[model samples]
Structure formats: C-alpha cells, structure tokens
Target chain A: MNAAVTATRGATALDIAAIRRDFPILHQSVNGKPLVYLDNAASSQRPKSVIEAVSRYYEHDHANVHRGVHTLSQRATDAYEGARETIRRFINARDTKEIVFTRGTTEAVNLVAQSFARPGFQPGDEILISALEHHANIVPWQLLREQVGAVLKVIPISEQGEVDFVEFEKLIGPRTRLLALAHVSNALGTIVPVEKFIKVAKQHGVPVLLDGAQAIPHTPVDVQALGCDFYCFSSHKMLGPTGMGVLYGRKELLEAMPPWQGGGDMILSVSFEKTTFNQLPWKFEAGTPHIAGAIGLAAAIDYLETIGMERIAAYEHELLEYATDRLSRVPGLRIVGTAANKAAVVSFTLEGIHPHDIGTILDTEGVAIRTGHHCAMPVMEFFNIPATARASMSFYNTREEIDRLAAALEHTRKVLG
Target chain B: MDLKDLYRDVIVDHNRHPRNFGKLEPADVHADGHNPLCGDRLTMYANLEGEHIKDVKFEGSGCAISVASASLLTEAVKGKSKSEVKELFDDVHALLTQHDAAVDPARLGKLAALSGVREFPARVKCASLCWHTLNAALDRAAEPVSTE
Candidate 1:
C-alpha cells in the first residue's frame, strides 16, 4: 500500500462515467436536481447483477435448504451452500464451517456474547472495546455485563479518531475475556490496524472479534491471515440486501460455544426429553434463513470480484483524498477525522450552522449526506460537539459528486451564516 | 404546502433565538420527553400556581422544529389554566395528525408557524416533544419529577 500512489493519486484518466452507469440508482434526480449520494457508510446502493441474482433465486430456486432431496430443494441447498463457500473464500477463512449466516452484525455480536461470553464471564472479567464502536457493539456488551457480571472496558482513542494502541495494550490483562473492536469506524472512517491488534490479543490469549462492517466493503479481508478469532459484517453495506450478515468464527471456538438460537434447522434431533443441536454454522443459524439475502450477497461478492477490489479500493482512496482536501478548504468547515489511513468517510462541522441544517440544505441541492452523531455519541463527546455532517463515498462515487457536495456546503454556509 | 415550507423565516427565527429556553429554577414540576427513533430529547420545567401554569420553560438539543415548538409551547401555556393547556395540547395534536382538521393560525398564535410541520412527516415528533413533556410534568406536579 504505497501512501503516495493511493491517497489523492488522481483518477487514471479512466472515464468514470462508464463505471457510474453500472449502478442504476445513481441515474436519478432528487428534489428536481441530479442526485449526488455520499451516504454509503449507512448502506450501499446495489448494482444490477446483485438485484438480478436475488430475483432469480425467488423465481427459479426457492426452498428450505439442508434436508430437502427434491430437485428445487437440492438446487436451493446447493445455491445456499455455494454462497457460504463464496463468503468463506472472499474473507479468506480457513473453512466454510466457520462462516455463519446472521441477520447482520448486531446478531453476530449478540450470538458470540450469548454463546461464549455469558457462562464464563465474572464481575471482574473485563471486555475491551473502543470509544468509536457503534451502539450495536457497545449495547450488547453492556447487556452481557448486566447478565453475567462482567465489566466493560473502553479503549480510548486519540483526537485524530485512531484508537490508542499503547493505551489498548495496557487495558488488556488476565481477566480480559474478549476484545471487540471495529476494523473501520462507521462515523470517522478510521481504519484500525487489525493484524497488529490481533497479534497482541493472541499473545494475551484473549480472543479478538473484528467488526468488519466498514472494512469488508472497501478491501479484501483475510480472516486466516489476520488470525482474528471472529469477524462480522453486514451484507447491505456491501451492495447486498438488508437483514442478512456474516459472522466468521474460528471453527474450534464456534464448536466449543453453545448455540445462540434454537429452531428447525439448528438441531440434529429433538425429543420431549432432550434435543441435540446440529453441526457448526447451522447451530448458530436457526429457523428459516435469509435465502434471498444469501443469494444477493453472493451476487454482490461476484460483482465486486468482477470489478476487482484493488481497483475499487484505489479509486475510493483517491476520492476520499480529493473530497477531504476540497472540503477542508471550505470556509468555516472542519474535518473531524485526520487518521493517516481511512475509508472514504468525511465528517465535518461548519462554524455557525448546525449539521442538521447543512444536511437539509445539501438535500435541496440533490446532495445526500448523513448528519447527527452518526451512531457514535462518545465520538461526538470526544470532539466536544453535538453532531457532524458526514459525506461518505463508495467505489461508484465520482469526483463531480464531491464537487457538488463542496459547492453545496459553500452555499449552505453563505445562507446560514 | 411543500415540506420546505416548514423552514419559514419565523420558524428559523424561533429556532435561532428561542424564548423561555432556560430552566424554571424552583420549577414545581420537571419531566423529560424523548423521540427514541431519531434520538431527540426535551427536558421541561414548570412553575405551577394551584391548577394553573404560572411559568414554563424548556432546554434540550434537537432539530430546528423541536426547539421552535418548545419555544411556542412555553409561550402558549404560560398563563393558561392547567385544563385549558391540556385542551390546547389536544387541539395541537389533532392539527398535526389530521390533515382535514382546519386550524385557524391566529388561534394558535406563535404555534401557527408550526402548522406546516405536518407536511414533513419525519418532523411531527419534533413539533410534539414540548407538548408531551408538558403532559409528563403535569402528571407528576404533586410529586417531584426527575427530567434526567
């Protein structure tokens, strides 16, 4: 990763107009102006391939998987299992048995807590997380602490929004059961050095869970290479459907942990007296799974592979640099996160105007950006502000969109100030 | 009316320089109201005289609609009887939810500016926060209510 070549390394004179054509949603107008969407951190827009895959699953092969012997059922099972394999390979997991289908990252975290953390954790046992974690990552631990008498420890972050590695090292001790942290912050887009953190956690014999909700979409994630105990991400944020996510837990750890949910598919045999749970992955995923969601995710993964993740990451980094430099120059605008490495998320505050006001004015100009705390109130508290206006980008976003956003911010400042 | 109409000159004015924006120190009743969906919060304070609201005030952070509505609500119920205020609150709720219910702007006074809030579906809670908190505070007037 050459910093100079990646950051603000200008587009390769490659016509982005052709690439933008792939996303159907981008070719529309909002509020009588051409839409310039910059809110990819929340959920990314899907390409035609992903959408068609979902439709094809429903139209041709739709059935409950795992036990069916009929042709449609076999097809469904094959397609579903094939998706699991795709995910396993995409994240570079050691085995397909390690990948579990979840509703999303929230469920994945809850599953780990309920299954592994609950029974063993004691009052003095501390779980280290970062101040930059989303509510999903924070609340589950708080709930687990209440239930199991475990203590929640927060890893303080620097003003630049990067987690303090030195401080995090000090926080880990004998009683630390798990270390859960975000790979890339949803609000600030600060990319955490996971491999280094994982190595440290491994030395302490504390399992690490990487919340790859932000990282997986931007770049290739190799769970085996990173040596993380668990990794989780949502499909919707990666051009797939909502209500479906992936949790990649090491096979040994998952096998040792009890089942989180119990239903039709999760069990091997059930009786009035005793019930035996099914094998790996299935035990974690109970009841009817998100069949369409899995199909959509596979499509999203295929589409991403076709475009090449390296190219996408490179293009997005350039876009982030361009957006950051331009937005920074705007009068009264202050960019919040200045980490050396980040995804294409830019959170900023304008001098006199509120973030909500800026977002409203931008909406009128057909530029969509997120406002408010971006779901990390502590991060806002760290900055000593109530909220910020965030303009997040994706591979599909163009330089022209960022210019429109910058122009809109200028107009908003003029009007508000 | 266009949804943007909610952001009229008067609405923006009230949002910028809200009246009765501080705590009613020695407030007889205090209560908090929150819109969990969007994370908007409002803390209300009232100084009641027998069955009347002698003075009312509020403080919190939220969208422009929320702050403006709080200001308008405090102004409307300040010197009014408790029962009169309750009836007024009901009238405001009806005006916001029922599109066909014709409400005279003059009758609502400063709150008339917020009538356009109905056009923006997402902003209805912002307009109702003060009213809801006032109700909560009044419910616990005899007993001390902790707004926090």
Candidate 2:
C-alpha cells in the first residue's frame, strides 16, 4: 500500500505531445484526414511498451505456468505471479490470494454470480442493482435468478442519469443478499457514489460487488479504502491487451465459495473417485491462463504508474469540461447524461437526425465516435431515444481534437438535418 | 465519398414529408422490420386488389435513408403486381450491396436516389431494412424481419 501511494503521487506534469508519440495507432489518418479518436470508452489504444512486453514474453519466457521444473517454466511462472503482485500493489489489495484472473469483466461477474451468489441465494432472496448497469452486470444475475428462485430488483435513476439515493436506501431489506452496481455508467458517464453506497450496504450486512470496468481506466481504485466485497474490471479499457481481466474478492469469501469451473490447474489431485481443489486464486483459474496477457497488463500498470493516475484524472477532467462547453454550443444538439460529476464521456443527440447518420457524416471528416445504444439499452429506453452519438476522451486527447469534433458535428447537422 | 451522394435532395425531401406515411385500415398484408444495431424500426402495410398492390403505406421511426426508401418503395409499387414488386426488391438490394452491379436509371426512377448507399457499406443495412420488411409483407411471413 505504501508503494502504491508513492507511485500515485510521484509523477511530474504530463506532456501531452510527448505522450501521444507513445501510441503508434494515434499517428495514422482514417479517411484522408488525421484521425480524431474519441471512442476511448469502447477500448483505449495501447502504448508501444505494452505491445513490446507481450512480444518479449512470447519470444523469451513462453511456457505453461506452475507445472514444470524446467527453466522456461520457472521463468514463466515467475513472470505470471509477479504480475499478480503488481496488480495487488496497483489497487492496494492486502493479498495476492484474493486476485483471480478471468477472461474479462463479463466473465469475472459471471464467476461471482455462479460461484458465490447462487450457492447462498434463497427462493425469495433479492439481488439489487442499479438501472445504469451494462448488460454484463444485469444478465448474469438474471441467469442466476432463473436457476435459483431469487428475484432481481433495480434502483431507478433520475432524469439527469443519476441513481436515486433515497430510493436506493429504501430498496435495501433483510432479503437483499448482494448489491451489484457499476462504478461508472458506460452510456451516461455518471460516476456513482460508490463509497457511500458501500457504507450503506455494510450497515445492512449485505456484501457489495462493483463493476469497475469503466471506472478503472480513469480513476485510481483502492480496494481497501472502498471495502467492497468484490471488484471487477477489464484490462483492455486501461491500455492493456484484450482477453484479460481481474476479479478481487475478500479472502474468506473466495476460499469458502465453490470453484465455478473444474480442470487441471484448479485441482490438487485428480482420481476416478474424487479430487481435491488447489489453494486460493489457482482454484478459480481452471486452465493454462492468459500468460502473455497478464505480463502485458503488468507492463501497462507500470506505464500508468510512471504517468500517475492523479495527474491523468486531472488532465482528462479539463478535457471533458472543454468538450462539454464546446459541444453545448452546437445548434439543436442536446447533451444527455449531464450529471454534475462525470468522467470524460459526452453522449448527445441531434434533432431531426438519427445517430447513424451523425456517425456516418463524422467519419467522412475523420472523426471516430461511437453511435448506438452503447450496450446500455435500458439507458436508451429510459431516455426515450433510440440511440445516441458519444465522444469519450482519454488523457492523450487534446482540446484541439475536441474542436474538430465540434466542427464535424456542425457539418453533420447541415448534411443530415 | 461525398455526403451529398448519400443524402440526396430526393431522400431529404421524402424523409421530411414521407409519402403514404400512415397505417392502412383493412390492410391485406403487414409486417414489421427492426434494425437492432441502431434501433431503427418500421412497419409496412399494403392493401392489395387481386394480385396487384393497390395501396401501400408505412408507419414507424427511422433514419433518412430508411424512411425515404420506404416512401419511395410505396410510390413505386402502388400499381405493380406482386411479382413486379419482388423483382424491384431484388434490384434495389443488388444496387445497395453489389459494388459492380449496373443500375438502369430509367428503370429505377426515383429509387435511384439510393444508389449512393454503395459507397457506405455500414449504411447498407439501414437502406435495405424497409425493402426486406416489404418482402415479408408480400410473402405474408409471420415473424418480424430483423437486420441485426
């Protein structure tokens, strides 16, 4: 925890121009013009350091981890376990035993839903979630409800795309077993008050699980300070490779829960009659895990540590403010999700023009923005709009790029309106 | 590709004031189409007299290309037989999808305004959603057509 705090507070000022050179994909042009990438919410572009780290792992220390006595096997095992330690320090977790590697955030949530929640749920029990969750957080619990007879309840949000805290407090009952919510709304960019919510749930003796897929990229997450029973986030959203994610659980709860999948690495010894499971973290990781992905993710964490999360957050907050002020000036364009506290995302719709048309016209000007439901169909349904065009920023983005986005939006209005 | 190619004057005019843009009472056939990708939806209704389409109308919400295509389709097939409408559907589909397919302007008439969709591959689904719904209505298919 001391190392993590030192890393967070150690970085100097971020030179935007110098940082842009580190990402190879940012230097290219898309439709005969320089590309203005505002789709960081979907997946952020990786730095060259992360790419080189994966390549170096495959070239030198390529082996299945934790099995052989050979030299390469030992090296690979060290690299993989070393990544676990790095991640433990990154989020300030007390132990590496609590970290379980999964495919991504979706799989991590599914693991908890099956392994932890399903076994203890009763017929009339309830799982409380907010309306702002991505389908990843909603559907797994719904599947669990189908298996067991538990019910799924939702806490509603306000017109500004904020969760109703008063209603959320009222929804907590003795029957509520778990509280699953997103730390940040993917569609609306509304950062939920997670600490307050966790405190409230703790009083009722209900464990909390936070979907930090959108939060981990922009903010520094301290699991100890948060006191969440479980926290899940993806690697690709934070400048690492895809197909890798982390699920941090309380040590006691993970040990007591049954393994979701049974295979070679998860078992201590297998026979025709019965088998014993392995220790913590390995019991949940069933196979030869994503070795290169873990190493690359560790490298990504190192790169971010050098830049510092606090500085990155401050830089992006300014970018979001600049973009919000600029985009609000566009005629007939209404910005959705105007929560007082938001991350770097801006979702909006133009009158008399569909989002698809807006996306197409923006592409011609070499501006890339996401257009659709953003996989939050309930958010779209709540607003009574089919879809929205979104521009999400990252630390590497500049105010000049926001100006280009605004200019392209103006051109879209003229073409489609 | 130029934005003007996709958003032609004809498409803009028809999208603003769509022809036959309401439900038909005592309709002979009706079917709904939905594009889950962009949440564009439309319902096609036709009043047929014998084998010919006597009247055609649509009621729904969509982008300019979808609404304009449906409006143009209704006008083109107002007096045509069922087989002729099917052939028109195939022709417009080819024009939207195939890059090298030749289009005869004299035959397509106002429907030729959608020829610009060939330049934009992603919008092809948006342009052809209404035509697929029209085919379902003509065939009396029960399931709703989806352009996923």
Interface RMSD of 1: 3.4
Query: What fraction of the true interface contacts does model 2 reproduce?
Result: 0.87
List, residue by residue over A1-417, the lDDT tens digit for candidate 1: 011122234443333565566789987888887888899999999988888999898899998888788888889999999999999989998889999999999899988888889977888899999989998889999999999899999999999999999999999999999999999999899999888888899999999998999999998888989899989999999999999999999999999999877889999999999999999889988898998899899999998887778878888888999899999899999999889999999999888676876877788788999988888888887898778889999987877778889999998765554
Error of 1 at A67 (Å): 2.2
Give lDDT tens digits, candidate 2, residues B1-148: 8889999999999988999999999787899999977989999999888889999999998888888989998999999998998888888988998878776768888999999998999999988998899888988733455669
Chain A (candidate 1) TM-score to true chain A? 0.96
Q: What is the interface RMSD of each candidate, in Å?
A: 3.4, 1.0
Question: Clash pairs of candidate 1?
Answer: none
Runs in model 1 deviating more than 4 A are: A1-15, B1-4, B36-39, B142-148
DockQ, candidate 1, comes to 0.28
